[model samples]
Target: MSPRVLIVGLNYSPEHTGIAPYTAGMAQALRESGWDVEVITGLPHYPQWRIHDGYPRTGDPHEVIDGVPVLRVPHPVPHDAGQLRRLGMEIVFGLRAATAPWGRPDAVVVVTPALFASAIVRVRAALTRTPVIAWVHDIYTAGLSETGAAGGPVTHMMRAVEGTFLRSCSGAVVIHDRFADYLRGHMGVAAERITTVRNWTHISEAPTVDTDALRRRFGWGPEDVVVLHTGNMGAKQDLTNVAAAAQVAERTGAPLRFVLVGGGHQRPQLEQLATTTPRFEVLPSVDNDTYAGLLRAADVLLVNERPGLTEMCVPSKLTSYFTADRPVLAAVEAAGPSAAELAAADAGIRVRPGDPEALVEGAMQLHDEWITTGGATHRGGRRYVREVLSRGAAVRSFVSAVAKLLPVTTEHRAPATVNS
Candidate 1:
């Protein structure tokens, strides 16, 4: 029998955005590589924080996605999720996952962001003598302090708890080197136990579409410069800065349109701001194909974060933006992982976070550069994705890393070459 691995997380396939794609992709890759994989996750409720249609609130908890067995646990679907409420939800899910009927697997991979729940999984793993690998997506304590969601005693307590959880894991896989540093230096995770595997673009080959027709479908004028921001519009995103930049463009007649596409707790606030902000628009999330076409059609892509949010998370949208062959404009801290990624890819431009004037100026600069250079300046992003962010390479690296954490035994199959 093939060695079995269990993946525990809050999100999975069919969500298409944020952490789901990565988790789902990893599970699929592992199964293709000859490992028996199972998933313990929550009901689909992400970017849009309501359970997806067809998934009843109370019903059969088991389903198969992409050929992997997934056991979904019911958790609170908060319409407006505050930090406390989010934590409460995680706790409930973690408790349920800990007691779930998932049989003992040779190894377990716990996805963080569901940090507290992962901690509970660690306790269960300890009891079962099952080695656990932590896949760190975001540092919860850093998020709380960096986004001004919480601080002081609360931040300190969370840091202690999170550190204990990660340190106890058999190993960890992080998307950025900076995350590895945090795990080793701050969280006391041994350096040898952490692996950095950058996330790759999960978007499939985008079908060629007529650019003019695509633009017209979205009501974008030929003369208008569209700066598009996709994915979660959460507190960390600080999309208000994007809205403010739109207002600045409107007042200055800059001909720039800032369009935010996604859902989150902050969407309502951004929509409210868009009511009076003529240059700003808010659109609901689009399907993957439409998302790809929108990315291809836009003049510039954007990554906006609240000021002082240096190291909590790296916006996953960068991967897709790079693949779209468009220059990116990031309003983020100069020292943060997002800015570092932009620099590494030689992709786009970055301005100080929360500065509307600077944001608009940067967007105009990109537009001018695109016109002058005829899109040649943005080739670096595509090259970076091809050379550095290959999906095959990332998945293979993760599988190899997980293989090392498993017990030495002939029952386990060797990791297979990942197909692109």
Candidate 2:
């Protein structure tokens, strides 16, 4: 009899980037490891507000993918930008998860994309008596509060609740050790309970792109100093600085073209501004293979997250950039986990947030260096990912944790059901 492992989260595949890849990869790997794997999640509205096109609404259940059975539960699409709607979605998903039908998992692994996600699963774990593994994708309560997403009263209350949930978790899995340290030192979670099983990219051996054709297709030139910004276009990005920096780059005759690739609510406004401005091009979201090709094709990969999100979040896209072996130009905090990783990997240069002048200067410096040297020096991030953070690695760590909690019993055979 094999152990049964359950992974719970909100977004998942065929969703792109962010938490989906990690959750889906981990579940599939656990199934490969011979565990009876199940994944329970809310409707996938991620990146976009609407429900994913293929699946039906709440009462209509779906197993959207194969291998591990994915139980797509319900949550209301948030309307107001208000915590009322957002928190309601979390609460609704949690409440509905209680009614979901599935054979009991020997161990439950819940992903904390939000501070509230852990809270919901904590409630579920208490009733089930199952060991709960909390996957820390972001240090959310602190991240949101530090960035002023919540008020003083709301911040204090949510932070306290989140801390309580962290302490309650049987294990807290963070992608970075800095986040784990913050949890141990600030939130009072014991050191042993937190594991650093970071996110990974599925590496490609052969190039998945026709780099030259794609470049021509996108109107990039041989000498166009293309600085590519790929992934979420959202408020957390201090785009005022990005815009201002573009202004500076244009003024200085840097002959650079800024590429904003991917979709989000913030994109249209950013696009409008860039269109009215100069040397900026906004491209729609690309498939994974195309995105990777674009990364390989670009002169420098740019990351422009606000300073506030630095330590609390790790842009998983950085992993992709490093794997692509491209030089980086980052508008991230000068100090923090991201900074440290960039410096350590010698992957890119960082500029302070809200200072577009510094951004222009940094971009100029990187461009000069890249031109002189002819692109990136460091490689092997893909190799590093395959060795350390692959799906196999995450699943082994997950299953071993479950084995500690639920030893397989001699008579414990899995109940037969549809392979959904």
Candidate 3:
């Protein structure tokens, strides 16, 4: 009879991507706090657009990871990034929602990777009258259309879908305040019903892998200064700036190596750019464990995004870099949400977005500074993440939000997420 919470999202880990880490961490955190939590999601394959490396499709349809029950239903592997492919994935998961056997939890938390995922949750919630907490990552209608991945009448249609989805929600959680504003100002979601619950990665243990040893395998030298970018290489990230920055490193003999990991629509462009540049190397993504190692391995973690589009999205990669305790060089939209975090954290340097020359100069200078100071030194941001951004803290914030959504129990109130 404990509180049971259901989280629905796409590309959850062992699944890896934006919401994956949050979904996995939140489910485990809620379970740890004595609430029975289950995640209802699609079959493992995303970004790669294939099933997860070792996991196989099963007739049983339900799997468990680290004691948190994962109910995986069928979803299409849409290789073609067309409207049909996108809709195909949403339709399959929406149908699975009806038939998936994860018991109806007292309250449901739906994480939207795509814009239309909310539409599905809205229909289901309306049918059952179940309370739903819609957690907005990036709204697909605006987010993807902004990226040109989803557009035309589809964009208009998605905006309409988002309208109803937000209206149907009992409560809404947005990662950054910009989104909360979007929900209220644009989607007509009431401000009182929305809360800004920041996204963060929770770590139980600090990284144990030897970054030097990792570099050895990846063809980077112990003395090499690494500029690592982890997570999606999407259009919005504007990785060409990273490539331009890498060119500066190569020219200046800065001994800086740019390692691009994770996948996205912009991956091919980054890959093509890297192919012509020796200082930049493309490494296929490893599991979450190896990804953690890469975070710590880099002397400089690059968290850059296109300028002007900052409020539309916040990079989850910043959480990983901050948690790993590495110095960040964020070349993002000026005065964006992430810039605010970087400034407040005093973590690393920030350059104005889209100015390739400025980005290169800033990156080159930061590389020189790191090498001159001590390449391996951790920053205040790392210390801050340890104190504030830990997994326990993140889950507690999410759990409390879920608890609040569950009619104000007035028992076992959880703490909010902090810089740790």
Q: Give the candidate number with the greatest lDDT.
A: 1
Model 1, runs deviating above 4 Å: 410-420
lDDT of 3 at 203: 42
The whole-model C-alpha lDDT of candidate 3 against the native structure comes to 0.73
Q: Given candidate 2, what's the lDDT at residue 42?
A: 77
Candidate order by decreasing lDDT:
1, 2, 3
lDDT of each residue in 101-149, candidate 2, tens digit only: 6466777888886557557767777787888888888887766675677
TM-score of each: 0.96, 0.92, 0.88
List the candidate 2 regions with Cα displacement exceeding 4 Å.
Answer: 58-60, 79-83, 203-205, 376-391, 408-411, 415-420
TM-score of 2: 0.92
Deviation of model 2 at 202, angstroms: 2.9
